[model samples]
Target: MYVAVKGGERAIEASYRLLDAARRGDPAVPELQVGQLQQQMRLLVDRVMAEASLHDPELAALALKQAQGDAIEAVFLLRAYRSTLPRFGYGEPLDTARMRASRRICAVFKDVPGGQVLGATHDYTQRLLDFGLLCPDAGHAVIQAASGAPVPDAMPSALAALAAEGLIEPQRPSAGDPEPPDITRVPPSYPLPRTARLQMLARGDEGWVLGMAYSTQRGYANTHPFAGEVRVGHVPVEIVPDELGFPIEIGEVELTECQMINQFTGSADVAPQFTRGYGLAFGRSERKTMAVSLVDRVMRADEFGEDRTSPSQDQEFVLPHSDNVEASGFVQHLKLPHYVTFESELQLIRALREAWDARTTVPPRSVEPSTKEVCAK
Candidate 1:
């Protein structure tokens, strides 16, 4: 055991050294710049930032490089780093209606008011690989806008149309002001509020969220949904300064927003109408946003008075297990030393066996011959 442990320690040290050397590559080769990663690997950086719950691109890029391009590792690093930073005041809630949309589409509408603007998407592209990228080209292809048609600043949501027709449930503005609970500050309990649920879903692992969403579609939640709007764009972030009473734009962040219209049966005074599920995340993460919407819907099964028969509908099951860092940490803890506990268990087992044998064992005793046996002899 000592020799094996020694060998393992040496191997781990060597592996780390090799990793550092490999990260730098050959001396002749130039090291990768974090700026390059931030700009070129924008989508990957965005994902790290979103999952990390921080919106710093440069830090995300640095974490990505240090993690050897592992997104989850980068997110873990970023979250750790974020813990050390001083907290500025919280920003105002974002207004998606005012977003300068680059890409907008609605599954419910064939022709939207602003017209569908497909920008930098592979949705309609062929699945075959292009060999053209292997070769370098000096010239770039130019894409011109439609001759007389001008794209609108924002596309109208199909939900608005449904609401106008009274086919969707009304979302009345809250009479009292209530700030959203910060999960980082205060841990969540069961029956999480909408804000807490959304916060958890926003930073949840993408693959897990996707699976949960897929399960709902496969009849787990028994949901039928239509994409009210899927928008990717830049939205202004604002905050009110202590000195200044009015709010001012701090910056703009690229975001993906999804609104899913779900069917609902009549309840009490409320007629049968459509209800909406919403998701918003940093940058253009369509799948993540869509998954968030679906999970958000399922998590609200109780509010809709739907039966919670699926794992996706269980808040206790989903919320705690969704965090990759927490899940990874707990799972990886199995590799840690458990000798003391195991030795204690072993001792208990041995003692139990001894007692059991003693109880079961028959001791030799003087036998009294029965009258019937004596007669047979």
Candidate 2:
């Protein structure tokens, strides 16, 4: 279960040097700045931040640079860096309803409260590569330009309307406003509460989440999810000081949230109402947001009396395996020396083979004719 890796100090140091050179490819070319990575590779930074559960964009960009653009490796670097930092007090739950939305869309309703603002999305753009991006001035490369319009002060959730009609399931908090368990602070056990589960999903690997969510679409869990609403915006992060005894806005972080509406059972099967799932992540991650939302709905199969027919539906299966850091460490550990364990296996196999040969090759003791039979012959 553990790697008993042994190596020479010289060899390890040499390997480290080689890795440094590999990370800094082609020194003759202009080195990439942290600012350039922050602007150009914004999505990469976002993914690292989400996976690492760290909010700093600059560090995320630096981690990506250090890891040579490997998202999982960048996440590992970021998480390692995060472990050293001191913990401040927790922030108040962001009121996403009052968020300054840059993009908002809802598949359930065509005419939402604020209308569908496409924002800076490539959804409508042509798939062809624009070679104009290679030029010094890449500003004009896009098919459409930003209108430079101000977003509304707040965009009400599309779910609000559905809730008013009593067609949607309620997600009201319980009494006493209990503090949610932080996975970083507490070791998780299965059958986690919604809050802890949501926190884990927020930091889960994007690729794995997408695969799990896609399984539901392909008739595995079959939630029949619609994009109830997907909002991308920046929300203020507030901290309540012990002395002050009131929350104050420290800063803001960009977040992408998805509220997926699923129609699992019809009127014949159950009451004709829609179930809702929530997903929130750091920065403008649409696919991750949608996937997390879909998976979240499937995870609630027990509450809604839906059958647990897929891996995604099982929280035990999903949450424990979704962390890329843990998964990557485990898989990569195979590269380490397992010579002692492997040698034992080899010896066992050889002994078994030798025993088989001895059993098969030994001539059956010649049936010695009984004395009477020999005499008769």
Task: Tell me the tens digit of each residue's lDDT in model 1 across 115-233.
Answer: 88777787999999887766655123423433335567766765677888999867663336467789999978788888888899999888888899999999999899888889999
Best candidate according to lDDT: 2
Question: Ten-residue segment with the worst summed lDDT in candidate 1?
Answer: 138-147
Q: Best candidate, TM-score-wise?
A: 2
Model 2 alpha-carbon drift over 4 Å, by segment: 1-7, 140-145, 174-177, 264-271, 362-377
